[model samples]
Target: MKMALSIALLVVMTSSAGAQYLGNYSANPYAPNSTGNAYGAGSPYNPNSVNNPYGRYGSTHSNSSANNPYAMDAPKLYDSQGNYRGRLSSNPYDPDSISNPYGRYGSRFSPDSVNNPFGAGNPYVPDSPTNPYGQGFSIQGADDD
Candidate 1:
């Protein structure tokens, strides 16, 4: 029984670690009309809603806010296959933000950055939002509706 229990614990630990490396498997916060989008604003009073200026995730003064430069919990972006892309932030100072031109995932020269015309930003890529001629693009993260 002891041996079985140990094996089970090991399995659980391994799975949890793997999931973390792959990124949080949550709904796409960047999706059009999503709570994170300015256009798809959620309840104006919901703490996590970007529409709430006083909310933790919405307040510019909060460390976890998407608008905060020091935010550590900015909404993450994931591809349709659940691949971890990066943080979906407009803060130019956040190292993980896709808007940071100097960051790995945000650099226009970086292959993973959406600003890279030859890479993730390519208009020909179906998943690229820059692809105006293609179907709508999608990503994952943020508070549930």
Candidate 2:
């Protein structure tokens, strides 16, 4: 019985660890380093930011998939004016997302919006459920110290 309890405890711990929000840096090379799992300043949930542990997803970039080989099927594109350009044909967040796997909302993962900073006029609208900052963050006077 003791052995079974230990095994169960181990499983629980492991499962929780997997669920921890660590961002998706190492998982997707094509993604910017800002939204990755690295812990530090400029991170979306830097404990210092208005939104602590800024969940795991945030704003996306327009040129993220430019040179990406898996740029296809990532997200539709657009110009600064929000014009519909085209859709990505590659899968950046698949489980096999090795090298350039797609992230949660099909947009390249970033640790937070601060680090990545998706410029204005991004045209990719995430069809998935993980896109939190697709429209971008606009906290006026947020920096008024």
Clash pairs (backbone) in predicted model 1: 27-141, 28-140, 28-141, 29-141
**lDDT tens readout by residue for model 2, 43-138:** 555543212333211223222232234433232333224443233223343422222323322334432112222422222433111234332222
lDDT for model 1 comes to 0.60
Residue-wise C-alpha lDDT for candidate 1, range 1-145, written one tens digit per residue? 9999999999987665542221221223455434434444344565556456787656778765656776776767665555666776668887888889999779999988878889777777666646543322233334322
Task: Please report, in order, the local distance difference test score of every candidate based on alpha carbons.
Answer: 0.60, 0.30
The lowest-lDDT stretch of 10 consecutive residues in candidate 1 is: 19-28
